[model samples]
Target: MSNVTTYKVTGMSCGHCEGAVSSELSEIEGVSAVQAAADTGLVTVTFTEEPDDEAVRAAVDEAGYELVGRA
Candidate 1:
């Protein structure tokens, strides 16, 4: 089965920001997909299992954004 989670993120301003967030999340081991919206500041992640929150936070941080927890 697949589990999809949406996180509230901040500091996204354009397509580049979306790509940055998406790229970081996509590199995670279990993440199957990533969709980051610069307008809404939402990052949707799909995976086979529940991914660690710390890992998610780190990815967002690395992308120069803030992970504001589940949405």
Candidate 2:
């Protein structure tokens, strides 16, 4: 079964920001999908397995954003 997790992110202000976050998160293993909303600063990630929190944070960081925590 797939699991979904939502995270609060900072520094996203446009569609480009959303795409950047989604692209980085989508690279993680087991991640089946990612939806990032710059308007709300929320990122929803669907995966087949639980992802490591550190890895998630790193992905956001790589995209030039910060993962504020779960939403």
Candidate 3:
């Protein structure tokens, strides 16, 4: 089944930041779509399965942002 998950991401200040976060998250195996908003610090992800929290966190970190847990 498909699921939508939202995570709190910090340090995004522009559209480029949003793209950076989204791009990194998209690399995850089951992720289908990523919507990141710089203004709200929310990154919404659509996937086929519940992704591991640590994996998500690492991707966020790799994108130079902070994942403040699920939203």
TM-scores for candidates 1 onward, in order: 0.96, 0.98, 0.97
lDDT of 3 by residue, 1-71 (tens): 78999999999999999999999999999999999999999999999977899999999999999999999
Which residue runs of candidate 1 sit more than 4 Å off their true CA positions? none
lDDT of 2 by residue, 1-71 (tens): 99999999999999999999999999999999999999999999999987999999999999999999999
Cα lDDT tens digits for candidate 1, 1-71: 88999999999999999999999999888999999999999999999877899999999999899999999
* Residue 21 alpha-carbon offset, candidate 3, angstroms: 0.4
Candidate 2 lDDT score at position 64: 100
Q: lDDT of model 3 at residue 28?
A: 93
RMSD after CA superposition, every candidate:
0.6, 0.4, 0.6
Per-model lDDT: 0.94, 0.97, 0.96
Candidate 3: list runs displaced more than 4 Å.
Answer: none
Best by TM-score: 2
Question: Model 3 Cα displacement at 41 (Å)?
Answer: 0.3
Clashing pairs in 1: none
Write out the backbone clash pairs for model 3.
none
Off by over 4 Å in 2: none
